[model samples]
Target: MFDGPSSRREFMKAAVAVGGASALSACMSRAEEPIPKGTDDPSSLPERQHAWNDVLVHDDAGNVEGPRHQLLLYVNLDHDGPPTEDDRRVLESALTTLDRAYERSHEGLVYSIAYSPAYFDRFDESLPDDLDLPEPRSLAPFEDPEFDRQDALLHLGSTRADALLEAEEALTGDRDTANTVTMESPLTDVLAVDSRRTGFVGAGMPAERQDVAGIPDSKPVPEQSPLFMGFKAGFAQNQATEDYVTLQDGPFAGGTTKHVANIRQRLDDWYVEQDFEDRVAEMFSPRHAAEGLVDGVGDNLGDSSGLTPDIIESIEEQAKQYGRVGHAQKAARANRDEEGNVRVLRRHFESTDDDVASLHFPSLQTGISVFEEVREAMNGTDLTSNPAIRQRVNNGILEYIFVRRRGNFLVPPRRLRSFPTPTGE
Candidate 1:
C-alpha cells in the first residue's frame, strides 16, 4: 500500500503492519492458513475443542519478481527428504507475495480464510488463485475486512526466531516443544490508537450500517472482492500435471516445465473446488440489498411483523457477521502470504469431501424459504413453539436438497458438481 518497499527486510516488516502478506511470496493469499490451536504439533488432529482458524498467505507477483518468499513446501517428492533450503526459499517468496497483496492501494487490507489441514506440508497443491499460472504473484492471505483490522505486519524476517519456532512447531507439533513467540498489537499500550489513527475506519461506522457505498451491487462481492480475485487467478491459471511435472525443455532459463505442470494441474483442481464457496457467498448477497442489511440495522425499525424486508435484512446481517467476526483470525491468516502458498502446496481439504456439510444444493432454497416462513410465523405471535409451520417447511424440502445451518431453505446450485454424481463416472 505504501510506496514499494526499498528492501526485503523493510518490506517484510511493513507488510505485516498492513494486513499480513500477499498471496504471492512467502506469505498467504486471501486464503487463510488453517491454524488448529491447542496442540503444539500441527500434524496431529485432536478432538474438536480448541479453536481452528484458517490463516494462510500467498504470493501474487509472478516468479520474475525479484522479491519473493520462494516457498519450497516439500522436503522430498518422495516422502523421505527433509525440508531443503529450496523449500525455505519458496516459502519466503510466498510470504513476500502475500504481503504485497495485503498492502494494496485499494481494498486497504483484509483477511481470507478456509478450512486447511493442521499440517503445512499437507496444504492443497493449488496455485493461490487456483489457476495453472506460470508463476504466481503474492497477495495477502486474509479474506475478511474485520480480521485485517486486527492483524498487522508479520515481520517474518525480524521475528526470525519466531518464524523458526513456528517451523519447529510445524515440524513436530510436539507438546514438549510448545514454546512460541508472537508480536504484541500496535493498538496495545505502545500508543493508544483512536479512530483518528485509522483513517476512513469509522467514517461510516454509526451510519456505516446503511452505507455500503463501497460494497458492490453484485451479490457477494466475490468478483469485486480482492479475496475472490486472488483466489480465482490462483485457481484459474494453475494447471495440473502428472506427479512429476515436466514441461518440454524450453529456453526459459532455469524454468523446469515439469515442476510447473505438476503443481499447475493440482492447483487447477483446487481452485475449482475453492470457487464453490465463493459462488455460494455471492448467491446469498447477490446485490447491495444484502449489503444494505447492515445499513438496515442502523435504520429505524417500523414494525414487528418481521416481513420480507426485515427478515432478509436479518439474514444479510448474519451473513455479514460471518465475513466480519465468525472467522476473523482465520480470514486474517488467509490474507497473508505465508498462508497463501500453504494452500498452493497443500491439497487435503473438505472442499473435495462427501460429507453432509458438503451436500450443497436446492435444499438451501427450502432453508431460506423456511427461515422466512418462520419469521412470518413469529410475526405478532410467540413462535417459540410454532411446530406446525416448522414441520410444514421441513416437509416442504426434498431430503436431497441442501440447506444452510439454522436456515430453512435450499441452497442454489452454481454448477453440475453440486449434484451427487459419482467420481470418474
Candidate 2:
C-alpha cells in the first residue's frame, strides 16, 4: 500500500518499525519474494547463538551484509527469584517454536537471548569466575546514560520484513502460526515485554529514511550507505571472530558477553557544516582524507576499515596537527589483543524509533571488560587534554552522537539459552 515513487522502499522500512498483524498484512501484500521456511530440528542450529556470519549475505568485496531489518525485545520475568521448572519449559518451547517456524538465516530468522546482571542478582549463586559481566555504567567523563536493567533481551533479525514481524507476533501471542508452522507456545506467556526497539540496515535504507529528525532536510544520505553516518562499518578484518568472542572454558563455555548501547544521533551539523572530506577525516582519519583512501561511503575499503597500526597510533599526532581525529582510528587503539586479534564483534544498526534517529549497538566479547576497554578508547578522553581536541568537538563523531542508554548481559550457550541459571547448569 504505498502510492508513489519511493513507496516499496519506504513501506518495508515503516512496516518493521510499526510491527503487528496489520503491518505484516501490508508487508505480505507487497512481498515480491517468498520467505524460506525453517527447520523442524533444533539440533541443526549452531551452539553459539550469536553466530550469523556464515549464513549472512556477503557483498561483492566479501564483506558480510547484516540483515535489513532487526527487532530488540526487552522483557521481564513474570515471577521473582529463580525461574521454575515449568517456566523453563515454557520458555524453551517458545524458543523451539521459533526454530521450527523459520530457518536460522537472514532470509528466514536469526535470534539470540541474553540475560542482564540484574536478572542474575535474583539468584543466590554468582556468575562463573571466568565471566566478567558487570552492570552497565557510564564509560566517559561526559556521558550520563540511563542503565537498562531488564531481565532479558531478545534479538530478532531477518532480511524479509514480513518474517521478522511474523516472528515477533508469533512469539508475543499475536499469531498462532509463523511461516505456516504452528507455534507450540508464546514467549509472552512466561515473560512480559517491557519495550520493543526496531531498526534497519543495508544499502539504500538510510537514504530512504533520511526525512527523519537527525538527518538534514538536504537529503544528503547516499543511496549505497548502509548506516545513517554515511559509511559501512563492522568489516570482517576489523571485527573479532566468533571464536575470539566466545567464552572458551567454564560452565558458560561457548557463551559470550554482550554490551548494548543506545546512542541518539543529531546530525544536522554532520551534513550541513562538514563537507564530504571533513566527514571522511572525522570518520576514518585525516590521513585517509588526505590520501583519498575512502571513496564514497567507504565501499572501496573492502572487508576492513583500513585502519593500520600506523594509522591508529597516529591519532594523537593527527589530533595535534589536523585538529581532529577519526572515530575508527581512535577505537582501533584498544580493539586488538596482544596477539593482534580483534577484540569485540560489533553488530550495530540504525533506528528511527520514537521518530528520532538512534543506533542499537550490540557488541559481543569474551568479557564485558574487553568491551569497556574498547569503548574507553573510543571515548578518546586522554586526547581531551590537547587544546585542539575537546570532549565533543574534533573528537571523531562524538560531536553528533550521544549515549542515551547502556546495558550489559551474558549470552549463554545454546544448551542453556532457555531461562539459564547463574551457574549455567
Candidate 3:
C-alpha cells in the first residue's frame, strides 16, 4: 500500500514480528503436551487451514496503517468430518506466510498505519460455518460512475499513483510528484484519489461503514457494501428456486450499488449488478471442483456426533437447499436460508447491456476469524478427535485472504492488462 519498496519491506517486517512467528510460538509452546493415545480422532474438527496472506493500508503521503488484511481469515465450521490437527498446522502456516510476505514488502515512499481496532485484530479463534454457506455477492472491482471502470481516479488519472497523490497535491499545491518521495514512511495510493474517508477503516472515523440491513458480522462487508448486516449475503439455489422472472427493458441505469439498490428501487433508474462478474467465473454452471477444499470435508470418525458438529450439520443443510434444483439466467438473486444455508431465487429485474458493479469486502472480521477461534476454544482433548484424517483448517482462510489480497495485486496487473487493450481494439 505504501510507495517506497524498501521502506515497505522494513515496515512489513516489523508487522510480521508482531503477527507471525512470535505469536505462533506462544500458542504452540503451551500445547506441546501430547494428546492421549485412546482419545485421538479427526472426525471432531471444524475445517482445514491453508496458506495465509496480508492486507496493509497506506496513505498517499508516507504513512501506513495496517491490519494486514491477508493475515486474518474465515473458515467453514460445518463439515462432513471433524476438524484435524493438520488443519491447525495449515492455519499456523498461513499466519507464518502472511508475516513473511509483509517482511518482504517495500517500506519507502508513502507509508503510515492508522491506529484503530476496527481496522485490525489479532485473535486466538472465532466461530466456524454452521449449516449455511455464507451469502455470496460481488467482492470487489469497485468502479467510478464517471470513469466507467472498476477504479475511479486511476481510470481518469495520468498515472497509477494519481489517486493517492490527490491529498498531497491538494494540501500543498505541489505539482512536483517526485519531490514527495520518502523512503522510510511510504503512503498508499488508495488514500490520495477520492479520499472520501473509508468510515471505520479511516483514522478518527465517526461511524461504521454502512451495511445492508441484515448481513452477518462475519463477512466484512464495507459500508459501501450493497448488502446489510445479518442479511449480508444473497443465496440462490437450484431445486428450491422458483422460475426466473422475465425482465422487461425499461429506462434503467447502472452505477455503484450502494446508492441505487436500496432506497430507489421503485424508480426505473435504479438497479445493481456485480462488477465484471460476467468476465470472471462465479457460480459455476457445470461446476466442477475448481479448488479442492472439500476433498476431505467428510471423513468417518466411527460416529456422526463429534467435534465441529455444527459445521457438519451446516454442510448437510447446504446440500439440501440445492437438491434437485435448477437455474435460469433471466432473473436471479443469491441469498441464504433461515439456517444460514445459501439459496438463490430467480427474481424479476431490469436489464441493461452495462453490468452493475460493486465492491464486496472489507467484510466483517468475525467471518474471517471464525475457524482459528474454534481451534483454540475447543477442548484440548477434541484437538485430536480425528487424528487419522488431516483437516485443512486454513482452506476458508485461504479463500478469503486470497480474495482480499488479490484486490491489491490486481491493482497492477489489471492496469497492465488495460494498457494493451486499446491497441488490440
Best by TM-score: 2
Q: Is candidate 2 or candidate 3 better by TM-score?
A: 2
Better of 1 and 3 by TM-score: 3
Q: What would the per-residue lDDT of candidate 2 be over residues 1-425, giving only the tens digit for each residue?
A: 48664787678788899887898888888877778887777788899998889988999888888889999999999988988899899999998888888888999999999999999998999987667999999999889999999999999899999999999999999999988888777999999999899998889898888788888888888989999989999888999989999998998898899999999999999999999999999999989998899999888898889889999987888888899999999889999999999999999999999988899999999999999999999888899889999888999999999999999998999999998988887
325-390 per-residue lDDT for model 1 (tens digits) = 111111212222332221111111111111111211100111122223322322212211333322
Top candidate on lDDT is 2
Number of backbone clashes in candidate 3: 115
Off by over 4 Å in 1: 1-85, 101-109, 112-115, 118-386, 389-425
How do all models score by TM-score?
0.19, 0.98, 0.21
The model with the greater lDDT, 1 or 2, is 2
Ranked by lDDT from best down, the candidates are 2, 1, 3
